[model samples]
Target: MPAITAENPLALPRVAASPDRAAARPVLAVTTAPSGLEGEGFPVRRAFAGITYDYLDPFIMMDQMGEVDYEAGEPKGTPWHPHRGFETVTYIIDGTFVHQDSHGGGGIITDGDTQWMTAGSGLLHIESPPEELVMSGGLFHGLQLWVNLPARDKMIVPKYQDIRGGTVKLLASQDGGGLLRLIAGDLGGHAGPGATHTPITMIHASVSPGAEVTLPWRADFNALAYGLAGSGSAGAERRPFRMGQSVVFGDGESLTIRADAAQDSRSANFEVVLLGGLPIREPMAHYGPFVMNSHAELAQAFDDFQAGRLGTIPAGAA
Candidate 1:
């Protein structure tokens, strides 16, 4: 029960939904990704085409995965793009990437690193392969998420957070192998180093087979879980979850997960990224990589980018 005061716009305290708990609804209405789509003379890698869990409010979209298999050498990656009125958070698990932004703040995010970027107001950025890594048929893997900015902060200056593995703390069950890595927000009375201007929480949890873990949730918020590896059951009715799948919990008490562990086989080893937050009930008009409240605003962002008014590359343009 972390306390989230009204003044703390970024704090997402847990509040239990009512007892009646609306009928259990599908956490993810639909899942889609940008995979198999041709991009700049390359065949999109299968790993990069992630199944989305688009249930959280104020959060417009999500890409639950990305992978770089050097063996394929199919230049599987996303080219540079522009964005506005939102934030992008990339969490690396098994690979690496180079992030360059219009603000001039960019860097290489190795495995176990979390890169949180705020494309406030407007910014042009790209996440592509580094010749050295891509040439080796580098085995790259990670996730990219999009968080919406409130109307007021939509035009603020862009910012970035590169949280390395050592900097992020982990909590595990005393009796079970279930473990939780706090990427952002607070959990078990502990706060992560990944600072955020928005009220959001993202946690990466790995549960051992036959282990059950319960996570607290806020009544006023929406929750989603992306299953990376392994299979398990979650949410009401104990729905089945498999790799490349996601589960969204309707307004409820909390999330209870149980991973399978059959003898003589790799215990149900699974990686799940859980996210939740309060929503911004504003209109959303999106074009390309930019998401604004109106079509007019989206148009203006493109115009500004072409006009070169975004200011000479900021201090750390990677």
Candidate 2:
């Protein structure tokens, strides 16, 4: 739960949005994420499961990777894999991970850090718990979001960005009841660090008990708020939501969230990841790790990857 914090939220820049504002958005849908196993047996909850792409255009999928506390020698990780035509944003809320890719991009992803990898053409990569964590065991919680590339930039180039938690812009609610971490994109004319090929806004907010957080949102971008911790309600409609749930918002200029008066010991407040992205509206042909525009492109990607055209494993590495 240590994904950036402030001793006094009131000291941070504030974003003003009133609950009674005429622009308050309404909740269109509330869905519970289904849990499953992923990448060498790590537990995951598919945040976009059962949600239509129309509501998530410019974004492919999202996985909430673990809130698990593993015992020694029990941690798991993903083997080498390939991806192309999109970007993968791996954000660690707790714990650490080491990632390596064929393009020579490698680093330790620590708590409250983000690894933004753009697999424009194609590349092979791996994500694993650090050896120390695997040996000693500890808490691991994170999220991996797949952002789709438009057809034009689908083959531009491959790149990576390491965004540290401290570098993100922190914002507070007008009443100081909520703390917001701006990871990527723009809010209230303030921009985040991670630059995206697509237009989108990524934020992590913690709302105090019985507190309300109202945020001004871009009217053109589709809005979403995924519950990461505690119980709360979303929208002016007041649909109740809790941990591991995703809320799809209808047209609006602002979002409203209220935390319950009482919360479990798991967290002190209602935590949520707010995402808003302009719809790409392009035909999407996706399979496995490749997201292309058509079946022919998909076949070509497979052929390219099989022939090692994507990339090779680093020397002396698995």
* Top lDDT hit: 2
Instruction: Tally clashing residue pairs in candidate 2.
Output: 0
What is the Cα-based TM-score of model 1?
A: 0.81
156-203 in candidate 2: lDDT tens per residue? 889999999999899998899999999999987879999999999999
User: Model 2 scores what on Cα lDDT?
Assistant: 0.92
Candidate 1 lDDT over 1-318, as tens digits, reads: 011112222232332223454334335432323354433443332321343324556666666444445564544556566778888888877666787877778888876888999889877787766777656765656777888888788899988988887777666643445667778886657787787777777887777778766666666678777676677778656777755666667776467666766422432366677787877777777677787888888888888878876544555433
Worst 10 residues of 2 by lDDT: 16-25
Model-by-model lDDT, in order? 0.66, 0.92
Candidate 2: RMSD to truth: 1.3
What clash count goes with each model? 6, 0
Which stretches of model 1 miss by more than 4 angstroms?
A: 1-35, 38-54, 72-76, 262-268, 311-318
